[model samples]
Target chain A: MTDLYLQDWRAWTPHRETAGECRLDTREKPAGAAVPSMLRRRLNLLGRAVCDMLATLDSGADSIVLHASRHGDGERTLEMLYGLNDGEPLSPARFGLSVHNATVGVYSIASGNRRSQQAVAASGGEWAALMAEARGYLADGQPSVIIVFSDQPVPRRFAAYAPESSSAAVVLRLGRDPNPGARRLSETSVELELETATLQPLDIIDWLMDRRRVVACPLSRRSWQFPAVRP
Target chain B: MTTTALEHELKEMIIETLELEDVTPDDIDRDEPLFVEGLGLDSIDALELGLALQKRYGITLESEAESSRQHFANLKSLAALVESRRQK
Candidate 1:
């Protein structure tokens, strides 16, 4: 769908906070209430994914969002279980933070865009669901939804049931067209291999980046070489 | 286990388990507080440490348990709990 003017893209990792960088007083997330370390790892990873999207996007996008971890805050779920056993003495803040929408909520809060569209997909084909929603939102042929795909590794608690890969988050700005010099959703990922098995998007990027070629490899899978984008 | 070894082991576990990044195993003092002064661990760290203890030692400390405070009070205290749990 990204037919024209979509070419520019950039990527980056946040500079590690130096001791001096840590001097900037960071506000407490979940405020005065503490979330588990794993949950905080999710929060931090969310920030990284969003930043990557913002930094690399063609800049033609007016609205954006992130889709992350199919598990959708498993650590929070774990905490909820813990809270129940701990006399049901749940922390209101932590409890509030456990909602599935909280991932997008944090982004909305950070960007000061109450109107920004964000969603989480518990599985691969959910992108089509978002695209379907976009069609309704953009019936006028105007761009609307910028879908992002980010996922974190599943926690050990659910390892047996809905096993997950390592921690990861991915952001994509889905729309009609990106910016000038931007690469359109060229070739329209004609036939995707949505593994009934979970796929980690970031892993795909890393593999492509490593091979400097878009190996047909699904992000999480290793054995199969689908097709490299180019040499 | 004697008190010194217990403290030594506690410090080792905290440093290794948390990936404290800024602190080394040797930096932690046995008598130093675990929550604030020494490692600056927050409640989440407590949960993580609890999980680690359970995984490694097969022992758990409930939040409401009276002995939990005494067990988690400091490195020395935690070591004592670990030693006793091991004995049992």
Candidate 2:
């Protein structure tokens, strides 16, 4: 298992507390100062969500960025495809940001971060893969790594095939070398036994913020144990 | 449609199609450029606005690539282009 410090973290979701229908809103809401207006205007919902959390974490300029998303920019991808089907010329900005790592690129531009960045996605084992990637960065002697996991629900046409999905982002600033041998248990030591593979990153953020040392999330089979916090 | 009314409609279309929030048609200046300097739009907005205008005004810019750039210079130019084409 990877041993790393959860130095800081932040999470955001577009859903407002409401009794109305559950759906994705594509508006580019103001996230933070990390993204300037010129760049912010170009970001789609997923990019804005990712940047919102990243800004909150104050991610290091040198920290490696690992953006793991099961469905990266799903809505934009669908729009591009539909535009193609109708023989319409796609917007250059949409085409530019539709790539998997586009959000990470935007983050780099916003924060002036030139460190190594990687995009990871898997039908299963996404979190596990993210952990492995962070471990690799630490082993390479990097000071820290930022892992931003974001996802948006698949479009309605593909909703039938996908599990329940929503738009959310989680940014974690992790480090292995914590202040010259601090003996605190690493956050990586936490074990989450999840029943379903569909573990939303927001659940992990909630668990980290709560006072509880262990959590069996209500709507999920994910049971997490945080031995790092034990006195 | 009058130029003033068409300009208002263009502003609304720009805001809606661009997904711009906290902005209204009254906020847009008829003489201000829509790209880069005035409205701060980029090439992507130009493409989106072109599509919207084509659909709404039932006009085509197929034969006028160079003039299309001129038409998109500002709200007045865009309205003039739309009005000129709508009368045809």
Candidate 3:
């Protein structure tokens, strides 16, 4: 188990449009001004949330990207399916962007960051998987890794089983060096415990944003503790 | 619709269907390429445009792969395809 420092992070979600259903106190939609219109037009709600978080995070080409999503843009998949079922030609863009890693691909091209990218789809242990992946990058002696986790509620058809959440995105820049540059926000040490999982990364983001230290979140069958962040 | 009107409608359809908020019909060159270099559209856009054209014109694009590819080559080609099919 390695102690990872949380150099920087950002979270985003829709506020007004989803106020009735999604209770998360999220900010307004992301403008994604940096992204060209060509690619931005293709982004759905999930992709928009990710782009919003990325726009706020000061990431560079050197940073490794790790994207985690419980259910990636499920709504888009449903739309494509409906179109196909109706014997209508599916939009190639919609079909292409429905995949798990479509957001990652768009980010790479839009941000011009050719660094290695990883996409993780976890049914329950997503946070654990993301942390583990970041640890591997740190062990490789990389300076920093950008981990983005996002999820959106599935269509009404799957809502019974999945009970989708409002669209959300959390971006974390993990680094080995505790003393990050001027962009340094806070430092967190992650330790995976052997207990059953309970809390999630989104909960951790809220806690961290609220400046709450000493958080104990679960990872898979184990629990991890994030001690108070240091300057 | 006349050629100019058809071009205008096509542009509107492309923008609305593809969700290209920043682009207007006037911005499109009549004979400019639709995918990649000119409009920077990809295969996905092609599929979407094809579907949109089919629905708007009340016609089915021929399944001839190579000919269909040519019809989608640019706004001019797409316009021609729409015009011919609508007239037929």
Candidate 4:
């Protein structure tokens, strides 16, 4: 079991209620003004959402960033695949941005953040893996870790493979000490029953907003539990 | 040198292919450098532009060739290259 404190969090989605400082506006794409136009132009919906959340999170410079996604920029990959099948060369920009770590790499470059950045992808328990990675960073004596989880609907061709396909990003700052307004996040191993994989970001947002208690994220055979936020 | 119709077309192609939302064909100076200076495009943009040129006009560039650099130097040079070597 791993115990960590959530220093702060911000989440974004196409459909969500405005919660405190975090506003949900689905009318327009996130400007991501922190990122220069050159790099911003390359961000897709998921990347923009992640950047948007990061902009408001105000993560410290020393904090490590971990980006977790179930299907990272699958649409870009699909486009490149189509071009290759048609005997046409892929767009170099699209080809470069198709990797799972591309968005976080762009974020790191845009923010001028030289801290360690990592990307992870798992079939069902990506959120747990992300938190575990953050825990590992904390164990390594890092003061804080920024975890960004972003996922979007896969291309239509691969939609059937994903149980839950939605666009959302959640950014959480984790630390060893519980600061003011911080929530306690506890990870415990539990027997996992057969359950459809839920969109972890939305679940996290719901938990942060006090709409839900205890985020039970099931990976393969084990589940990570986050106990209810203490008052 | 005057901006020819081909140069204008190439500018449009650059703006569209690069997704330069703030840039228009008229915003591109015919003689301005396209890399690291005038238009502020980088190596990735150059590669994307190369692929766009290949797809639209069936043009290709040899890797690391001094002549290729000259052809991609500016809008006028790119239009001239297309005029001479376009397969489609």
Candidate 5:
């Protein structure tokens, strides 16, 4: 089990009317105010949500960034596929921003952050991978690591092959040192094993907002426990 | 010398293709640079604009040709290129 301090967090969802302390205006898309107009134009809804959530958190310039997504920019990929099938030349902008790391790359560029950035797209257990990555960074003596998890529902073409999911994003700043105002987060392995399971962004948001003690993920056979908010 | 209908249309196309929300047809100076200085566009925008031109006008640029860079240098050059080369 590894214990880490949750220095700060912000979450967003298109379906939910409220996400903990952040109340998103459902009528309009997230403006991504922190990102400049030039770069912001490249982001889709999910990317914009991630940027908006990150803007609310104290993401330091030197902190390392770890971004995980189950379905990274499926719409853009689908568009390119259609163009290819029709023998139409692909849009260079779409092709350039189609990579899994493109969202975080845009964020890094907009924020002028030269720190280390890692993008993960695990088949499952992406949340666990993110937590493990954050823990590893903390153990390596990094002051703080910014962990972002964002995913959107697969495009219509891939809906049959994928499970149903809503668009959501969660950004957390994890640190080794505990702060009195921060929440305490720890990971524990559970004996119950499942064949395929992954913690969703909504799971983390629910755990953080509600008075829940344990959020379990059978996919990874691990559980994250929010022991208490430090006083 | 003046902004022609095609130039106006090209400006609108540039704004729409790049999603330059803050810019309009009137904002694009025909003789000014479209990249790296006046409009502050970068390589990605250049590629995007090239794709847009290809789709709309069947215009294809040789990536290594010096003339292609000159054609993309300003809106006036782009308009001139389109007037002489546009297929559609």
Candidate 6:
């Protein structure tokens, strides 16, 4: 196991958007149109997000990357769905943006990234699932890098799934400094457990990534924060 | 499919993939160029269309092609390339 580390994290949102603005959006009211714009708001946001992340990570030219979002650009999908509901068929533009990889496409194009981006969605366990994937990359001997992203909830059509929580992004890295024992297929094994208390998977994710870590695991979540090394 | 049908399909795919915003299959001229003052595609469009073509058919575009400019000239040329490179 590589010594996993939280390299850093970055997030972006328009003044009108709320998938991520930190505590800027503290509304417990129902999520609705007033919520922040998630993906597809502005290409500038995509570039801004990626550029800021690169700086924060100190990522090299060849650093591998993975991004996770439960509803990748679902706000755009909701808009398209609403258009469809009005008996007005979706425009071709709407169709393109509706695809899950649209933002991924934008990121790749803007950054000129050569390595493939690991974009995955876990429906509910978005963060934990993505965290696991990031760890896999770390264990695989790649300079493990992961980016977790989520957007604000859509309109009332998705009311049950919403309290319009703000979106966030956290970037984790591993392998720069090797860990000892319980590291790999050799000597011993280490089990990495991430438990969250927030009702929303994203809420749990928010808890795990919060600077203060509102929730705590029995042992030291920070000590084990570094992955076991395979020395 | 006939050449015209292939061209139509290619146009649809372009409009769909590029998010051309206000374009339709009918809006595109069958023989119009797709790049450089035609459909006006840039590098990103090339990447997306290339991927879509590979999945739809089995012809993977050479990422480092020297003359992709001429290859993506327009819908007609793209249709021809797709037909000629159609997987056996």
Candidate whose DockQ is highest: 4
Tens digits of per-residue lDDT for model 6, A45-135: 3333544454445345356666666666666778878877987544444466557565555555444567767777664455555555766
Which 10-residue span in candidate 4 chain A carries the lowest summed lDDT? A19-28
What stretches of model 3 exceed 4 Å from their correct place?
A: A14-26, A55-58, A180-201, A211-219, A229-231, B58-70
Where is model 5 more than 4 Å wrong at Cα?
Answer: A23-28, A193-197, A228-231, B1-3
Instruction: Answer with 4 or 6, whichever has the higher TM-score.
Output: 4
Per-residue lDDT of candidate 4, residues B17-73 (tens digit): 999977888888989999999988989998888888888888878868999899989
TM-score against native, each model: 0.48, 0.75, 0.81, 0.92, 0.93, 0.51
DockQ per candidate, 2 decimals: 0.04, 0.33, 0.73, 0.81, 0.77, 0.04
- TM-score, ranked from best to worst: 5, 4, 3, 2, 6, 1
Poorest 10 consecutive residues of model 4 chain B by lDDT?
B1-10
On TM-score, the candidate that comes out on top is 5
Return the TM-score for candidate 1, rounded to 2 decimals. 0.48
lDDT of 5 at A65: 88
Instruction: Tell me candidate 1's fraction of native contacts, as a decimal between 0 and 1.
Output: 0.00
Q: Count the backbone clashes (under 3 Å) in each candidate.
A: 18, 0, 5, 0, 0, 10
**lDDT (10s digit) by residue, model 2, range A65-141:** 89888878888889899989999867767787888999889888888888789998766455656767887888878
lDDT of 4 at A220: 45
In the range A93-182, model 3's lDDT, one tens digit per residue, is 778888899998888888888888988887756776887798898888877788887876668888997643656677878887775432
Q: For candidate 3, lDDT tens digit of each residue in B10-78? A: 888988998887888888888888888887887777778777777778767665579988988887888
For model 2, report DockQ: 0.33
iRMS of candidate 4, Å: 0.8
- Compared with the true structure, all predictions reach lDDT values of 0.52, 0.70, 0.71, 0.78, 0.81, 0.54
Task: Order candidates by lDDT, high to low.
Answer: 5, 4, 3, 2, 6, 1
lDDT of 5 by residue, A1-231 (tens): 346888888777766657436444342477777788888888887787777666556446566889998888888899899889999888888888899999888888887778899999887678888988998988888878899988888898889988777788888899877876677877787876675446778777777777456777666788887765443
Candidate 4 residue-wise lDDT, A81-182, digit = tens = 988999887778888899989988888888777888899988767887887788898888877789988887778987787675677788888888878977
